[model samples]
Target: MINMSILKSLGLSINPKLHVTVLTGAGISIESGVPIFRGKGSMWEIPEARRLAMRASPPWNNKETWEFYEWRRKLVSQCKPNAAHYTLVEMENYFENFCLITQNVDGLHIKAGSKRVLELHGNMWKGRCMKCGKIIDLPETPLKTLPPCCECGYPLRPHVVQFGEPIDNKILIEALKASKEAELFLVIGTSGVVSPASQMPILALENGAKVIEINPNPTVLTPYMSLSIRGKAAETLPKLWKSFFTD
Candidate 1:
């Protein structure tokens, strides 16, 4: 059960009228069997694989790059959205203005039916044309070509923002705006390391939002949160979601 004491100790007053913004990270999907990039079984743990995931090395159209993304597509396709993802969807319905900002490219939040999601890392289920700059939704089934081309006959790249690349300016600006406007900011399951994304909760704090962190352990962001609830988000989030009701 969620510690009801959190209400008193943290001095948090939950109401339906507040604007809630949630930020999630790879830790939320670990239960769904998504391989985190820094973990032991990660697809990017391989030396050559790391090169393909970063903008510092091979070009997006390289054979190795395409092979890596193909394998990644298969792996991600097999995973499903977890309870935490579903809770976010429910939370969205509970509040009038809710926005989900995620560092994961897995598309689990979208899979769980979250309508107002902003993926800071782009998405694995989409591909961008290298030449034509067109964005297309990629299917889970194997593509006929290794370097899938656009209708314009140009090679496609994974839509994710790779290391050494900037987050899309438009998306970043919107996320920041959401953070600043949030009455309550929920920081869930993130390690508090990744850039720009890591900066979001701070912006929330600066703008007078009550930041609540739900993670199994303390992170760089833990101390700043108005309350830090120690637990897995899959378990903790559902309880928090239920508490929004008066019943």
Candidate 2:
């Protein structure tokens, strides 16, 4: 069962004067109908995205990967931001200094009206030029055929960092900066088990940020958090925000 007393205390403790940095993961979007890629019975792991992503080999770069990703794009393209997303937006609006760093590539937070967002994993709405370093914008929905670059003729790939790929330095630097400067770090939906992303919460904690974790299940970083609200973000965030600040 969820503890409302803890939630009340957390709300009371928040200092609106301090900067708030939120790090989000795929779990938040699961309620919006996107697949949770890493959790139990995840179908994405069956094909092992890491192998293909490492070299951009067959299946990763081939027609199959394109078809598969197109299906994923179709699903993501149809999804809309849920209550949790709106709650974050409201939080940002209320706070003078607020930063959101998300691990998911679905682009829901941006769609939900977050002004300052650092996509730790690059967005799926964009395409990358394989031949050149240039980025190409693509339709949010899947294209009928492989997309071509404007400057170069090579096939454009999803802008996201697939398994085995490194996170973009620019995004990483921004996240690090936010983590270092944040006085209140909120980790939502993430299990804190996924590599470098998991490390950000710890870095924020080390930098003297008060950490608050929101997840249905206990996570590796739970011990370090100032409060842990065990529930879905969609249900919990809005309640927390509404209880403190009225519309």
Candidate 3:
């Protein structure tokens, strides 16, 4: 259990008016039956699948991408919002200035009713036209065709950033700014190995936010944590919320 006294001493309260930003990874979704890709001891993740998402020939298009995304989309669609997700929504409601920055493209945060979410990686449910750049929401049901076509007759690709693709500068800028501006920042369920995502909490720390990490195991960034609460997010978050944010 997290020692609330230690956190309270750091100015955490039932309701903080301060700006709060949370960065979440796959571990939070495990209770929803979602496989964690980037956590400590995770067996495997999306790399193999992402590679399959790309095409072989000249254009190097996301030829098989549709296959992977469709499978992924169906997998995610089966998962529901867990307690941790609901707790974040409650936190968002309590904190006047709050933002959720998630590395997972699973779309659970939005589904859980968090309004100010920045999906650092785009959601699988969205796709962009390879030809005209028109982005659209993909259907939950199986597509009739392999690679869906855009209104312009061009192949569409999942909106998610490919492995080698640099994060969209605008999104990175927003996440960084949020980290700097936050008075309290939470890193949840991440192993802290991935770039950019791993860097956000450090920015929050340097900028003087009370940085907290909630994970089942200590990660590389554990050394820098102002306070580390070791536990699975599904179980820990709701308890933390009840302890700190409830009447």
- The per-prediction tally of clashing pairs is 0, 0, 0
- TM-score-wise, the better of 1 and 3 is 1
Best by TM-score: 1
Whole-model lDDT, model 3: 0.80
Report the lDDT tens digits of candidate 3 across residue range 1-247.
Answer: 6545544767766456788899998888777887665445443456665464453332323556577667667777899988899999999988888989999888898899998889888877777787798987875648777677788888777778777778878888999999999888999998888999999999999999999899988899999999889988888888766766433
Question: Which lDDT values do the candidates have, in the order given?
Answer: 0.83, 0.78, 0.80
lDDT string for model 1 (1-247, tens) is 5635444444556667788899999889887888777856776766766665563234666556667776677778899998999999988887888999999998999999999899998998888887888998887647777677788988788788877889989999999999999978999989888888899999999999888899998999888888788899888888876664423
Tens-place lDDT per residue, model 2, 1-247, is 4434443465434446768899999889998988767657554565654443343443243555565566667778888999999999989988888999999988899899998999888877777766686777666455757543446677777778877888999889989989988887889999898888899889988998778888989999999898788989999878766655432
C-alpha root-mean-square deviation, candidate 1: 2.6
Q: What are the TM-scores, per candidate, against the unseen true structure? A: 0.90, 0.85, 0.87
Compute the lDDT for candidate 2.
Answer: 0.78
Model 1 collision count = 0
After the best TM-score superposition of candidate 2, give how far the Cα of residue 132 lies from its true spot, in angstroms. 3.6
lDDT (0-100) at residue 169 of candidate 2?
Answer: 91
Better of 2 and 3 by lDDT: 3
Candidate 1 regions off by >4 Å?
5-15, 39-41, 44-57
